[model samples]
Target: MQRVRLVDVARDAGVHPATASRALNPAVVGEVSQATVQRVRRSADKLGYVPNTLARGLRTSRSYVAALVIPDITNALFPPIVRGAEQVLTEAGFTLVLTDTNSATEVERSQIASLRAHGVDGFIVATASWHDPLLDELATEGFPTVLVNRRCATSALPFVGGDDQQGVRLCVEHLVGQGHRDIVHLAGPSNTSTGRERADAFRAAMRDHRLSVRQTVIECSAYTEQAGAAGAARLMARRRPFTAVVAANDLVALGAMDALGSAGVTCPRDYSITGFNDLAFMDKLTPALTTVRVPFTEMGAHAARRLLEWIADQPPTATQSMLPVELVVRGTTGAPPVD
Candidate 1:
């Protein structure tokens, strides 16, 4: 069977091959007229024509592929982010290559080097640490890279994510509004921006409400459930009389819940809890989790779009794109119980 080519489609559409190519290419779709674009698309659809991406890449000197590097693929929070970025890249006639580094810095650097060596056009990274030397190096080289959901403190890299400080403030305020004056915080690791920002925000919010920050705050080694449980246990061992717990993220909140249950405590009866990120299934928990919802999908999509702009030699107007957050009140929070 003879394979249909761009020339064949162009002939069927009564236009030159160049015009048809321009019409079909998403990167340059605006260069062609709408009527011509429609005609070429119809002809190509009728002939079941598929674009030769390899040939197009050779002509444009672009692989039209982007790499999205994440820290932990096993986490439930990343799937929505990946899907959102994938959708935007696909529509732009590009492919996404996903890599997970298990939160290892050296492995993440190696993955980026490998992807660059293989000629990937750009990158969207979500594994940046607070002081990432590798990311600084990439920025020094002026690479087309964007940070998503995480960012480096030293690099001038464009980032898209939720406002961690504002989100934590909302959580603290919510718990305080319920008369939880003595609230404990299970903070994530201090090495990452999300952890540090949220932890600092928790401290500031508590101080603003005239609460003791040092006595109620406990730092976790990582953002895992085990770390959360350990933090909670440590807080309890300190003999601090607190009526509420504010976890840095949903997974941490779940861990805190487990720790409290094992100690014969019940949520909203003995204590109330709040979580961040509002991950899936929070509403269906034994006692629905009250959390702050970050726009994960929007963050992913915006990061992809920003990378594309950079790749096209059109830098974004801002270096930081902070998406808004919302507080979701549910069954896990209530007024402090009578002592």
Candidate 2:
């Protein structure tokens, strides 16, 4: 089968190859008139024209590819982010390469090195530890990198994520409004920013509500369901007098539910629970989960766009872009059960 070429598109559009090239090129799409751009785009679509990314990369000294490094690809919270990023990158004529580091620092470093060796133009990392040395090194080396749904200790690099502190506050407030005064928190790992910030926020929010934080917070080793279950079990073993649990993420909340059920506790009947991330299928659960909804898709899209701006030698207007979050009420949260 004959591959469609730029010349054929230009011929069909009644324009020179150079004009069609400019019209089709994402980088210079603005240089051409909107009418001409529309015409050339229509012609290219009709001819099924696919740009030769390799050839274009060689000419521009760019791979036209970006790497999306995440902690765990299986986590449902990340798919929406990936979709959003892929959409923006695709529109910009760039391909997105996804890599999961399994929350390992060395693995993440090796993945970054491998992607760089393969000539990826930039990176959108969602696996940043609070004090990641690899990310610091990337910053030192002036790599075009954007952090999504996470941030480093230092504010040198650009990041896009939700307002973790505010999100936790909303969850706490909602539980409090439901008359849940004795609430426990299922915190995530302390190593990552999301874990640390959300945990800290939980404490602060609890304190702000004039509630005691002591003996009410249990940190999970990781964000996985296993960690959440263990945390919940530990909290239960302590015989803590709490009527609600605020999990750091949806996975943690699910784990908490598992633990509660095993202990013969019913959600919103014997106990109320709130989760973060508002991940997919939360509503479909036997008792719909009440969670904080982060703008995962927007965060991903913003990170991709920011990376593109950096790759184009344009500095971002802001160092950190924190999107807003909302508390999603569901069947899992209600007024505390009468003892």
Q: Which one wins on TM-score?
A: 1
lDDT of 1 by residue, 1-339 (tens): 999999999999999999999999999999999999999999999999999999999998999999999999988789889988999999999999999999998899899999999999999999989999988888888889999998878997899999999999999899999888988889888889998899899999999999888777788987788988898889889988989999989999999899989999889799999999889889999899999998999889999999999989886644899999999999999999996
Residue 246 miss distance in model 2 (angstroms): 0.8
TM-score list, all predictions: 0.98, 0.97
RMSD each, Å: 1.1, 1.3
Residue pairs that clash (backbone atoms under 3 angstroms), model 1: none
**Worst ten in a row by lDDT for model 2:** 313-322
Candidate 2 lDDT (Cα, whole model)?
A: 0.91
Candidate 1 has a TM-score of 0.98
Q: Which ten contiguous residues of candidate 1 have the minimum total lDDT?
A: 311-320
